[model samples]
Target: MKDRLAASYWLHESQYAAMSSSAVTERRRAAMERFESEGFPTVRHEDWKYTSLKKILKAEYALSSPFSEADESETLEFKDIKRFLVNDIDCYRVVFINGRYSSWLSETTHQGFDVCTLGSAWKKYADQVEPHFGRLTEGLGATVQLNTALAWDGLYVNVPAGVTLDKPIQALYFTTGEQPVFTQTRSLIVLGDGAKAEIIERHQSLTEAETWTNAVDEVFMGANAHMHWVKLQHDSPSAALTQHSVIEQKRDSHATVHTISTDGKFLRNNLDFKLVEPGAEARMFGLSLADGQQLVDHHTRVDHLAPHCVSRENYKGIFDGQSNGVFNGQIHVHLDAQKTLAFQENDNLILSEKASIDTKPQLEIFADDVKCSHGCTVGQLDEDALFYLRARGIQRKEAQALLMLAFAHDAVADIQHPSLQAKLHRLIGKKLGVDMG
Candidate 1:
């Protein structure tokens, strides 16, 4: 796989030598070299100790390029795409099919602020794109480096200073092809001082063909800016995803991210937040439902670099049918970051005796006056509560499903969008095999 990736890099570099600027090209080369040197993370790597990539590495996958113009993406219509979208919402849409942009299914704009594809932004606004494209994701990990070397097109949103978007933006990526494919997607989001925006992102596979996606998102929040980002992962059983999100918050900026994963063969999420200036705050919430031998892993980190910063993380999971779950969360408070407040929690419920989970919540405090705490819990459903529900004329399965819904409620309670919340409820119900209405 590494050799194939190396060959593909050279092929792409020669094919589109003029696609990017000299500096950007150099950065890509550097990233590729780093990836070649480090390769993929193994079990020996502390961060990836609980997860294994043997299933993905053994299979031969065709690497997808954004410059490919041979895909049959135009055949899709609103009906085929509506099932994956959030209904009853007025928002700007950007759709990509097999890593290629689909104009017919996308509604982009540059009316006041720019909300369009990163490919167009690279061509039209190189000055702005150059400064913020790969700024936040340098030396993060080998997978990130691989993405930087191969990424072509993804969503780009820039809200100007003092401006607030009236509606949210939805970015959707669908995978459909005849053969197994591996795609790399890069996205850049920038919010100026006092600007506010909301974004919803999803990746889906339209077919049963095997597909693998490596996505990286770099978000920058200026002073007093606020951002709400949500990621929904409900792909086919043959699909796999490894996603990384890096967020940099400036003075007094606030950023919140929600990750909801219900289906997929294998899923791993890496979320990192850096509070670079004083009074910045970051919040993260995640929920995962794994069944039928699926594997879901989440790793999160928060760095308090300045004084008066706050961060909170809450993650929950339910494992059944021999599925496995892993969670590793860390909160680091620097020496000079006094008056910091941080909290972390991970809770999991095991339905089947065969199902299992590994959770680790860590905290490192260098500041003496900081208030920080971390904890985790692994348990089963309350027998008393289940018996009470069963005694009231409810079936065992329905009663268990109701208890699971209540267990997963707090993870999504912070979402402000009513329609998205409703859609998420429906998805959860479908995953649990019961009606949540």
Candidate 2:
């Protein structure tokens, strides 16, 4: 499998290297070398101790690339993909089909700010793309290296100082092909000083052809900038996803992230926040519903490199029917990061006897004056609460669903958009087998 992927990389490099800038091509070569050396992580790796990629690595996957020609042979239209989108929302859209950009279905703009593909940014705005692209994820995990080696097109949004986006931006990626394949997506978001933006991202498979996706995102927030991001994950049962996101904040910048995972065969998320300046704040929330032999893993890290920074993390999970879930969160405070405040928590409810969860929340503090705490819990539904609802003439299944929804509500409570929040409520209700009106 490694040999085949390496051959594909070389073939792409031989054909496209001359067209790209030397600096950009060098980065790609270096990243490919790193991936070749490390390959994929196994259960023996420390960061991946609880997760195994044996099933993913053992299968044959065809790599897709482009050299000035469209690789999409499947015909699609806006009506064909309308159902996968959020209803009753006015937002700018960016859609990709089988790792290629779909210009007709996208409504990107560049009037005051830039909202387009990373490939376009490389061609038109090299000065802006060179400084931030591949900077945050240069020496990270093997999957990140692999994505950097091949990904050429994805979402790119650059907002100028003192300007706010008119509406949220939606980035939708759909996989469709007859054969098993792998795709790479890399996105870069840059916000100038005092700028604000909101973004929604989703990935889906249109067919049951066994698709795997590796995505990487790099976000840079200037001073006093605010950014909100919502990620929705509910792919087909034959699909798998691994996403790595890095957010860097300057002085007084704030970042909020929400992750809702309801369905998939395998899913893993790695989120890292670097508070490089004082008074920066980071907030993260996640809710996961796993069932029927599914595996979901979430790992997060926050580094307090400056004083007076604050971070908070909360994640909830519900597992049933032999599913397995894992959560590992870490908060680190440096010696110079005095007066840092950090809190982390993870709670889970298991509904089946065969289901299980493993959660670990850790805090490492080196500062003399800092307030930090971490905790986790793994248990079943509250029997008393279920009984109380059932005694009011509610059906037993309905009562259990209501209690579970209540437990998972806090993770999505901070969302600002009513339409997006309503859509999430419906998705949660569908997963829980009840109507959450």
Candidate 3:
């Protein structure tokens, strides 16, 4: 009976009956075949060992169709949140409602920046699109394949070379609908040489709608370019999200990724980077706080293919309830990549025995005369520290909140924007159920 049920479940999710464009038709068909051959990736998969898909693929869920009416105001704008904070960012805004682009909610930029749907870009930039589109994350995994097959529309941000916009481009994906849907949204962000920009990508849900969102984004930081990318994923309890961020760094480019994940029934993230030229540097800062029966996972790889490159990574997690968290980080140093300095550290704190974390820090060094180190630490709150806070006239709840804040400070401090940092601190305080001055 178990085998029969699992097989039926896999077939339902594997259902593919439509296509919107023939842009990547051949590649999409090949991906569908790969999904059929690979079947569903269970705990047996190396990267998914800590997560269980039995609940997500139970054969009873319905796939969400193309959204005709996705209310952005009813979904993403929360009364309790500072919605005005998102108002001032200058770059063009593209909003996706239930996996489909919502033209009513999003408008095109008049000048300087070009914001269009992925399908349109596929038609317009046909020659240039074929090379970079769907190329970097081709061989990732089953979820990625599923995204490639089911994705109908996404966002494309193209900044003319040497154009520096004062505003940060924002893309918001709302994943709330009637049924548990699996949707893929792709982004191709191109920065011409000496371009300067900031981007903030927000992913969230409107209702407690059960759904699965598989998203992918490709960022090309041209030579001497600077970018700040923020990915915020905090949905309802009945949602599952998997996102892949592939960043390609050219000569003298600096790009930093700040990831903050708070909610979701299940979550997995892959942040892969390729430093293709000398003097390229990338820093990845991530934080996840899981409560309830949630399971959050982060898997990252930073590849140093060229010499004189540097990469630094720091990821931290705090869990309560029966939540489970996983962190797997790999730093690869290739041959001829001399003077490569890389550092990676993962820290996890579990507040309950039922809540657990599994962290693994992996390093692959094939070159000589390079400095690289990776480490991870998992533990609980310190009682002595708690007592110290109490002795200092801090209440119990405040003490826990204070400790949690302190634990996440390193990650929070890395945010490039002070407003963003303040917002994150407020959100973290609320999620931890702590109110402090």
Candidate 4:
């Protein structure tokens, strides 16, 4: 693994060196050094205890490179790619194929606000990219550093002060190839004071070939800003994904993030939120549906650093077959953060005897005037509800599916986009082998 990574670094050395002697280049070099020293995380790490990378580490994966127009033409067609997209909605779309940006399939804008690629931003607007590029991810873990060192291209959005985007921005990443491969993508979003925007991010594999994606995102919200972000993970069963997102909110800002994972062989998500100023509010919601031999894990942390701040976290999971699920949520209140209110809850449903889940919700309070609480539950479905549905002239399978959907209703309801929410409902129903109608 180290040899492959070293070769990749040298292969892209020219590209990295061409960025000029700037802070971004220095940060990239530092990240490369850190990843080289720490390497990939293992079960020995406390946060990674419930997840393992034995299989992914052992498999040989080709690193992604720039794709040519001919390669794109031979890889996929718009007709086949449209199925992975959400229809009946107007969105600024940014598409990437095999880790390279596809301008032909994208709809970007820079008239009033910025909706473009990180590579372009780095080349064209270095001043804007330098200040906040590597600021939030300084002491993050190894995988994030790996992404910083090797990321080819990703979405970048900047909403100016008091501006509200008319439609959401959809960032879609699709993997298509005949060989086992890996891709690292990075994104950054900045919202000025009183700005508002909605963003949707999705990852999908167009083929059954083994693929691995390591993605990282950093978001900064100015005072009085509002942002809604959603992550939908529905890759092929032969694919694996690891993603980390860091969000910072300023005074009077509000942010909400929803992560829904339904398909993959192995998946892990790390989400961190920092309330940097007074009156900040944050909400996080997650849902994982694991079947077959899949594994899904989520680790989240919310930090309350200012007075009069509030945060709420809720996560739900449904496991079937021999799948496994894990959830670890933590909320921390600083010593000076008085009048802080935080709550966290995690619940799971095991549908098969072979299925399993591990849930831990934790809270740490340092201020005397703070209110914080956390709870978790792991159990099977309600027998009474199942019986009631079965007796009402419904098949057992459909009844179970209906009950599962109802169980997940709260988390799905938090989604603000109507079209995306409807699409998720249909996908969830299809995954459970039932008609949602």
List TM-score per model, in order: 0.97, 0.97, 0.89, 0.96
Candidate 3 per-residue C-alpha lDDT over 315-384 given as tens digits, one digit per residue, 9 for 90 to 100: 9999999999989998999997899999998998988889999899888999998999888888888999
TM-score of 1: 0.97
Off by over 4 Å in 4: 66-75
Instruction: Give the number of colliding residue pairs in candidate 2.
Output: 0
lDDT of 2 by residue, 1-437 (tens): 76776777888795546545667778888998999999899989988888887767655776756653555554478987898887577889999877788898999999999888887787588778878888888979899988887867889999999989998899998887787778888899999999999999998888778888888999999999999999989888988889999999999999999999998888899999999999999999999999998888999999999999999999999999989898999888998899999999899999999988888887788999999988899988888998899999999999999888889899889989888887888789889988876
Q: What C-alpha root-mean-square deviation, in Å, does candidate 1 show against the real structure?
A: 1.4
Of models 3 and 4, which has the larger lDDT?
4
Roughly what TM-score does model 3 have, to 2 decimal places? 0.89
Model 1: weakest 10-residue lDDT segment is 66-75
Show model 1 residue runs off by greater than 4 Å: 14-17, 73-75
What lDDT is reached at residue 332 by model 1? Answer: 90
Clashes of each: 0, 0, 0, 0
In model 1, pairs of residues that clash are none
